[model samples]
Target: MSILSALTLSRRPATGFVIVGIFWGGFAAHVPVLKAQLGASDALFGLLLLGTAAGLVSSMWLAPRLDRTLGARGMQVAALALALAWLFPGHMSVQVLFFVSLIFVGGASGLLDVTMNARVSDLEAQTGRSLMNANHAIFSVAYAVAALISGVTREAGIPPGWVFTGFSVVTILLLPVLRMAPAAVEPEVGYAGAYPLWPILLSGLVVLVAFMSEATVEAWSALHVERTLGGGAVQGALGPTMLGITMAVGRFSGQVVAERLREVPVIVGASLLSACGVILAAVAPVPALAYIGFGIFGLGVSVVAPMGLALVGKLVAPHLRTEAISRAAVMGFSGFFFAPVFMGLVSELFGLRAAFGGVALLALCAVPLALALGRYPLRTAQIRP
Candidate 1:
């Protein structure tokens, strides 16, 4: 399907993606300020972010059930929750409180993440169109826009609290568009079948690796530009802005690529390209070169998680899609939270450059996981006598 058609088919979920992206992009651009406010060392800051990891894991586990219970209003409820949750972190100056605030932020984000992705998968199944990449591209576009705006706000000396509050209002305003259609009922099968654990596990692992690499950049690229390369606040914000913009371009291109290429080859090639980009970013001596590296990395890694999630939807039974996706998301989304900790510890010991190198290594690991997916059997054993 064309990108426009795919977007239209999954517009509600796409809006959810945009909401999530806007919050994260703005937060990412403000990471330097947040860390400074807490007076946190790299190690301590990483540990604090573990609060988010805890919340994300717990909420993701509950997502399928929550989605079922909320039905058509799932997205709206989740979005509103996230809007409120984000308000705490920016307003907090205490380390403990900041950590606590992240927990709420992470939980709300995880809830929305699973719900929206599942919604997109449902649309893809219903329409027989590959919509995952298109919907995710909307997220990348929104993220880039938010990052730029946040940068401008930061330059104007606006505090993160007001910036977050503004974005929260924007999210609340979009609530109406997040209403989903009622999910169609599935036909009952004669016997309960074993869940397709293998595909979900494999796809989840691929997504985990992809997100780990992606998150490392989102969380630390600004620091790399500002502290490591001696850039100003606007320049630091540009780090993630560059990544978001390139990722949008990459994901939009991936929509077309998905129509023509096999999944395994595409993932494998993209992983290698991302690895190269990370290595270059790690080694770059100047902010401009680092931006180039980030751009290249964003272009390559943009499609990996979306494709991984799409693979799970394609491999699992329709009746189990929501549960399967929730399980996979728990695994995948953990990477998003854990990565900051990983980078922080590494940065504390070795420096941001070495931490980025570690990310490059993580990117390369996706190749083998993608190959495993290629060899896995296609027939999902959804039922057994």
Candidate 2:
């Protein structure tokens, strides 16, 4: 299908994911600007980020319950909340306010993340099609574009707050777009049933490993290229930049293949691909080779989380779908939460190559987890919108 047709087929979740991508992409690029504006040290900013992680984890825990209570409206409110909360960080003058604002920002984002995934899962059930990967690909695209623009604007000396304020309008526009979506039905599965605990747990672990691997490369690839391989700044930038581009491409490819292939093989193949990429990067003698490995790693590991979540959506009782997803999301977010520390500790003890090798080992772990998940029985009755 054409891109426009695919997007039109899945407009609601697509818009939500893209908006999130834009918000975060801008936030990522403008972080240094925000820190400079507030005059915070690296240690202080690190602590403030910890607050964001805490809020995100806490909100992941809360999202299912919130969804149960508010149904479809919860997603709309959470998306808007994420946009509004995003505006606070760039404008904060006080350290305390900056930290507090991030808490709410993370909370809102976590909520929106889970809700959107749940809705996409519901949509999948309704349509009998695979959409998780395409939805996520749009997110990456928005993130890339927004980050690039943020960089350009920063170079031109635009204030971070004004940039973010302008971006917030994108989320606000989503309010009307989402409102125009067909009215939501009561989920075919009711909310009071017991979730299949072990299957969800295993699936969540797979997601955790996937995210951890991706975050490791994203956080440390440049340093690995520069410090380890003695590459110049431009070459160093190429590591993460290529990884980001390949990740989006890989995910888009996953969307194309997700429906054609069974979930287990896709998960296993992607994990192994990521494993090879990281391992190759670990052993590369030159910066150029390492960049290739990082790109390979990005392409291979890209499909892991989306496939896992899609599986969880298929396996769980409809009533408990949101909760199951939130549980897995918390696990996935934990990877994002600890990846820096994990990379730092490993690099400190064994060096960057060893740290990346360790990431390779982590990626390998997902293969078995994916196999284990394949043993779970899917629900006989599917939920449809």
Candidate 3:
């Protein structure tokens, strides 16, 4: 393909999707460290994450309407505000700063979540191909990079606040994309009605399971390794490295193969792959085996969320697809933000091993939802655009 064609393929939502993944992926890598540094208990951590998801859910309903009033760039600016606001949580005393910061972080992450999807919805309309998986692959790579950077920073004895602050500065890259993107014009004359909520909700449920599984790995794998498996902290941290690498590979390549498959079979195949991976990883006799398990798990789930998200991009009415996508995404976000806390609780209650088993179980949890999404593939789903 020519450079112009590649650029065209990547423009609009595809570009924003990558940036969105990179920024949030950084935030994701820090959860383990954040929990450790704050000395937060499991239930508290879950609640804090839930608060963030609450913010995202609220933004989902508001984003498309706001898009109508302000255009895509306007929505992007609102999201930018929230991303900046997330930095304060890291510096707070566990007693005071943590909860307050959690609220801000969740809200900001949530806002960005909705706005970016909205941007991608429009961009997909223009680009006319399945870009979601590739974009999420960008997120996986960024997530791995972010986790690695955080590991290095932790080694340097930097606190979470400083790490987040650095990311905040890096967030300035978002401004140019927001500025250069054109405003949404009126849609094709036939556009009408909001996206039916049930299908989107079901799709959201699918993501909720997949992301929850992912967050379980990202947030707690290190703890599981060091505390449960009797491994070094740094060595323990490699779970996400493996997961991210596998996810990136699967998703980047999955996007190509996904173009050849329909929604259901791909999701079913990927879900089964992830479910099996998690069971093997979680039950592995040793840490190395567990690492391999996580890699397989990553490959299994890597495609689930992006493919679901791509469905979101195609399903709803043009004006409302972003809103619909956000709604679906908030469910997944809730799953992600909530899963760590639940795992922490499981660790607190049973053991880290069993808690991880909970994560493994969700792979199966996702299968039903993925099948649900697949069942109704014709429910207004257009091609990726």
Candidate 4:
């Protein structure tokens, strides 16, 4: 199927991806300023980020039921909640208030994340087309655009509050696109049976590793460029902007690749390539080299999580789709919030370079997990276009 067709089929979830991308891209670009405003040590900041983790865990438990309760309106509700939640953190100066704000941010984001991903899986099952990569590509595109805007705004001395507020308004403005037909209710009876654990676990691990690398870079690449490599604000912002651009290229490329290649080899090759990118960034002597590394890393890692989530959707029974995805997402999406903490602690104890080197090691760990996923007898008939 062509990209336009895939997007038309999956536009609702695609909007959710764009909303998430805009918020995070702006947040990533403004991290240095946000950190400075709070007067947080690296370790303390990492600890504070744990609030997001906590909220993520709670959202995972609540998402399936909430999705069921909200039905077709779930994405819109979650998006609005996320927009409201994001408004607080940028304005917060107190560490305690900032931490509390993150919990709400994480919870709202986690809800939207699970809802949109599961919606993509549902659309894929109904249409028998590869849509995840395409939808996620939209996210990367939005992220790159938002990061670039945030970079320019920061250089002009705009406060984080106004920046976040602008994005939130954009999010609210975009909500109409998320509307969809009411879902056919599945009986809740059979869903309580045991989900196949091994597939969920393995796929979740693959996503976890991919997002750990991604999260670390998104949260710290700017700092690495500025503090470690002695670049200025706009240059530091370029770090994530480069990553977002390359990731958009990679995921859009993957949408085409999925038509021709099996998922396993693609994932394994991407993992190895991402490992190289992270290692290069870790040892880079200057900001330009680090940007090259981040671009490479972004290209390789962009497809891993989407592919891993697709794997789970393919492997599980139809009745178990939402729950299995929520569980897998909880495991996978936690890495998004968790890696910042890991990066912060590592950067504190060692250095940003060393912390990024550790991310390289984490990227390599996905290889074996993908191999294990290949062992499962995927319902090949279901996934073919």
In terms of TM-score, which candidate is strongest?
1
lDDT of 4 by residue, 1-385 (tens): 5777888889999999999999989989998999999999888877888777778778987999999888878999999999999999999999999999999988998999999998898888777789999999999999988998999999999999999999999999999888754344244444464558999999999989998789889988998999999999999999999999999999999999987787889999999999999999999999999999999999999999999998888887776777888888899877856797889889999999999999999999999999999998765323222
Q: What RMSD value applies to candidate 2? A: 3.7
TM-scores of all models? Answer: 0.96, 0.84, 0.87, 0.95
Q: Extract clashing residue pairs from model 3.
A: 52-106, 124-385
Worst 10 residues of 1 by lDDT: 376-385
Which model, 2 or 4, shows the larger lDDT? 4
- Runs of candidate 1 with Cα error greater than 4 angstroms are 188-193, 377-385
Ranking by lDDT: 1, 4, 2, 3
Error of 4 at 29 (Å): 0.3
| lDDT of each candidate versus the true structure | 0.89, 0.78, 0.68, 0.89
Residue-wise C-alpha lDDT for candidate 2, range 160-268, written one tens digit per residue: 8888888888788777665322224355534565558897899899889997787677656766777789975445556666676677888889988886888898999
Tens-digit lDDT string for candidate 1 (1-385): 4989889878899999999999989988999999999999988988888888888889999999899899989999999999999988987889999989999999999999999998888877776667888888899999999998999999999999999999899999999999995457364467376778889999999999998899889989998999999999999999999999999999999999987886788899999999999899999999999999999999999999999998888787777888888888889988966798889989999999999999999999999999989976543333211
Q: Assess candidate 2 and give its lDDT.
A: 0.78
Off by over 4 Å in 3: 1-8, 11-24, 27-29, 75-79, 180-195, 377-385
Off by over 4 Å in 4: 181-194, 380-385
